[model samples]
Target: MNRIIFAAAALAASAAIAYAQDPIVGNWKTELGDTAAIAACGSGYCITLKSGKHAGEQIGNFNGKDGSYEGKITDPDAKKTYDGSLTVSGNALKMKGCVLKVVCESQTWPRL
Candidate 1:
């Protein structure tokens, strides 16, 4: 019984270690006034962007899951910045932009 218990404990510990080493612990690829924003977390994610000519003129909503977040994002093309709000789940992150507009979109991506 003691040997079985030790094996179980070892397996649990290994699983815990693997969870601790997750890579999607931060915000990623965010664009302002455009279509197609990118972000990954743990093993879950979400993405969005405005479509068409009004792309950069609209702000997208962050419907993030899991537990990730956005502290800040800069748009090189627009030469502007957006304060980020993020939600993360496993390997997914839902995002919302601080700027105001009418764009709501989400998608999951590989953890980066």
Candidate 2:
């Protein structure tokens, strides 16, 4: 009985660790007024459009922690991919995409 209790405790600890997700895992309202979902995918997070004209499209993939990330972001309308970085603070997520690490555009997405 003691071994069983120890095993259960170990399992609970492992489960807690496994499910300790980042704050960026959730849905947000994009600058375009659409909904975007960010969820864990493999070793990184994937951003997908959950509403509006671009629904069902995956627009970004990022890898990082503590509210900062770096990856590539794709413009659905232009069909272009750019180097991107993201920062999350409070209920806002600032997304930036750049060309050659120079010219860039940014948008702040609110948590949904």
- Write down the TM-score for model 1: 0.36
Q: What is the lDDT of residue 43 in candidate 2?
A: 96
- Runs with alpha carbons beyond 4 Å of true place in candidate 1: 1-18, 26-66, 100-112
Q: In lDDT terms, which candidate is top?
A: 2
Instruction: Write candidate 1's Cα lDDT for 1-112 as tens digits.
Output: 9999999999999999867643434433333323454434334433334354444432332333436554544444475756666665665545554565455334344333
Candidate with the greatest TM-score versus the true structure: 2
lDDT by residue for model 2 (10-93), tens: 999999976786878899999889999999998999999999999999999999998999999999999999999999998999
- Model 2: residue 63 alpha-carbon error in angstroms: 0.5
The CA lDDT of each predicted structure is: 0.48, 0.95
Candidate 1 yields a Cα-based lDDT of 0.48
